[model samples]
Target: MKTITKIFTMAAAVALFATTSLNAQTMMETDPNPAPKGMGFKVGVGINGGVFRDKSPMDYAYGADLKLQWDLTPYVAVTASGGYTKLIAKDNAVDADFIPAKGGVKVFPIKRMYLATEAGAGIAIQDGAKTNFIYSGGLGYEFGGFDAGVRYEGYVNDSASTTYFRKTGQYAVRLAYNFKL
Candidate 1:
C-alpha cells in the first residue's frame, strides 16, 4: 500500500542518510554552534509508556511508544513517533495505535529540563476508526545525551467529521543518546 511504502520510505531515508551523514538530524545541527556539544540535527531512538484513551476517558488504557527525535535548532527540534496503546476490554482493542509527526520549540531554561511546546498533526488508528490532528505539549529533561520527558496530548479528526475529543495523554520517559558515524 502507498501508506506502508510512505512510512518505510521515510524510515529508510532517515536511516540511510543519517548513517552516512555525520551531522545531527534535529535542531542543534542546524545551528552553527550548539550548546549541547552533540545536540541539533540528531536522529535518536527511544521508547516510552503511558496511557491512551479511546473515544472516552472512562476507558482503561496503557501503551508503549517508539519514536525518532531530531533537534534542528539551537533551541528547537521535531520528533516522529508511533505507538500501540491498548484498552482493557472484551475485544482487546488498541486504544491508541498511530504514527505521529510532531514539531515544537524547546528552550533550556535550566540544565536537564527543556521548556518546550509543540503543535503537530498525526494519523491515529483505533478500533477501526482513523483519526487525525494529534497534538501535545510539556517539558522534558536530558543528561549525557539521554533524554526522559513527558507530555499532555490531544487527538482529533482532520475534518469536522471527528467524534473524538481531548483527553489527557502521557508518553513513556525517553532517553536520546548520540553516536559517531
Candidate 2:
C-alpha cells in the first residue's frame, strides 16, 4: 500500500541522514574541536505500557508498546515506535485491538534530560482498518544508557464526515535503553 511505502521511505531517509552525519563526524575528528559529551549518535529500543482510550464500546484499553530511537546529537533525536493495544471485554463482539506506528523527536535541554514529541500515522485495524493521525509529547531523564519518561499520546480520527477530534488518547510511562551505533 501507498501508506506503508511512505512510512518505509521516511524511515530510510532518517537512517541515511544518521549515517551521513556520523561519517561526517568521523571526518571531523582530525580537527581541533571534538564533539561534546553526549554529542554523538545512538540507537535504542525499549518497552512501554499505557492506557488506550478507544471509542465508546471499548473504552479504556491498556496495552504494551515497543520503541526504536536514534540520537543524532546531544540535543536532538528521532524515534520510530510501534505497539499493540487492546481493550478488555466480556464478549469478543465489543473488544478492540489497535496497532500504532509513529515517528517523532526528542530535545534535550541539559544533555541528560529531554522534552520529546512525535507525530505520524496509525492504522486501527479492529473496527474497519481505519487510518488516523497520531501524535504525542512528553519529557524524560536519561543517565548511563537508560531513559525514563511519561507521555500523553492521541489519535485523531477527524474525517469529512466527522468534525470533532480527540476521540482517542493514552497516557503512558516508558523506560528504554539506548546505545551509540
Candidate 3:
C-alpha cells in the first residue's frame, strides 16, 4: 500500500510539472495582458468537517487551516498549509488531535475549477503519540475569492499496534476565503 501511494504521489508531481511547463510556454507565446489573471500570491483561512470511517473510534473530525498559495500560471498554483484538527471520540474512546502541515499543487482544468493533491505529516498533540503520514486529493471551485472543496484524506501509521496513529480516513469539506497578497 505504501508503495502504491508513493507511486501515485510521484506520478501526480510529474504530471503537475509537465502541465505547468506547457501552460507557461503557451501563455508566454500568446497572452496579451501585461497583468495576468491568477498570477499572484494569496492567503486563505478555512474550516473543515467530516466523518471518519465506520471502523474508526472517532465519530467526526473538524478543523481549521491557514493556506498560502502562489499562482504559477492561470492554470497552476502551488500551496502550503497548516491546520489543527480534532478527532472527536466515540463512546469510551479517547479523543485525538493533530496539527497537519502540507504542500501541494492545484491544477485548473477549466475556469474556476481545480484539482488538488497534498501530502505531509500529521503531528499528534497527545503525549507519546507518533506522527502520521497524511495525504489527500480533492476538487474545488473558486469564485469571488472563495473556494469550496471536498476530499478524502487519510492518516497512515507506520506501526499499527501503537495507541495512536492507527490508519484512518475521512471525507471532508473545506470552505475558505482568500486574500490577495
- Per-candidate TM-scores read 0.54, 0.60, 0.76
- Top candidate on lDDT is 3
lDDT of each: 0.55, 0.66, 0.85
Q: Write the per-residue lDDT of candidate 2 for residues 68-173, one digit (tens) a residue.
A: 6665665677778787766444334444456778888887776477898988776666544456687889999887788789888776764531222335677778
Candidate 2 clash pair list: none
- lDDT, candidate 3, residue 1? 100
Q: Per-residue alpha-carbon lDDT of model 1 for 42-67, expressed as tens digits?
A: 44456555554554442444555555
lDDT computed for candidate 2: 0.66
Q: What are the candidates' C-alpha RMSDs?
A: 24.0, 23.5, 21.4
Ranking by TM-score: 3, 2, 1
Please write out the lDDT profile of model 3 over residues 135-162, one tens digit for every residue: 9999998888898999999888657424
* Model 1 TM: 0.54
TM-score of 3: 0.76
Error of 3 at 76 (Å): 0.7
